[model samples]
Target: MTKPHRHASHPKLVARLKRAEGHLRSVVEMIEAERPCLEVATQLQAVESAIRNAKQALIHDHLDHCLDADSSEHDRAELKAITRFL
Candidate 1:
């Protein structure tokens, strides 16, 4: 199988991760400040959703670019690896 390389969507994926990181930091601060449990939970949920969306975007880009460059046999193996994330 070919090694994975960065694709056009990589920058967007990085941005999403950075946003999630920032949100996570905020959640930590909220906790430190003794914020309400519900408020902290809401922010945590946003972080989780951001991470999930980033993962989906990465998988979509990988399938689009990597699969197109590889053989059918390799594609099947790559697809199996990808499905494990889903």
Candidate 2:
């Protein structure tokens, strides 16, 4: 089996995701509290942005460290596929 590849940025990405999780919880609390729609939407947007940035960072780290001169076409294809999220 292939060994797992770890990136230096993983901790930061996890931290970002955790913050997004907290933001999501706040969004739910806001909804339950009957907050204004605009306020909720703004907070929700921040959560979305955080998650998106984390994902993009992870994908970039993968491309940078996991793929190399010996990487296969399939791997390159997968790289293209993953970027669709960004």
Candidate 3:
């Protein structure tokens, strides 16, 4: 049997991850520069928040565009599994 295709990666998600990469680099710089503990912690938190937001955006796109576009019982079960993992 052929494998199922879930949400394929797209440009917008790639761009978001690139931006997150920059944010992660900044976090490393903050550590190397010996910035104050609080400031470094804040940037770390920002990295977490950025990742979470990006994940949500990708999921939103997948739900709105892919899952919503396909509505068979098999698709519904696949969606349920994906949602559980998400």
lDDT of 2: 0.86
| All candidates: TM-score | 0.87, 0.87, 0.72
lDDT of 1 by residue, 1-86 (tens): 47647788788789889999999999999999999999999999999999998998888777776665446876888788996885
State the C-alpha lDDT per candidate: 0.86, 0.86, 0.76
Candidate 1 vs candidate 3, TM-score winner = 1
Poorest stretch of ten by lDDT in candidate 2: 1-10
Candidate 3 structure quality by residue, lDDT tens digits, 1-86: 02554455567778878888899999899899999999989988988887887787776666776665547788677677667635
Backbone clash total, candidate 3: 0
Candidate 3 local lDDT, residue 4: 52
Q: In candidate 2, which residue pairs get closer than 3 Å at backbone N, Cα or C atoms, i.e. clash?
A: none
Candidate 1, which segments miss by more than 4 Å at Cα?
Answer: 1-4, 69-72
With a 3 Å backbone cut-off (N, CA, C), the pairs that clash in candidate 3 are none
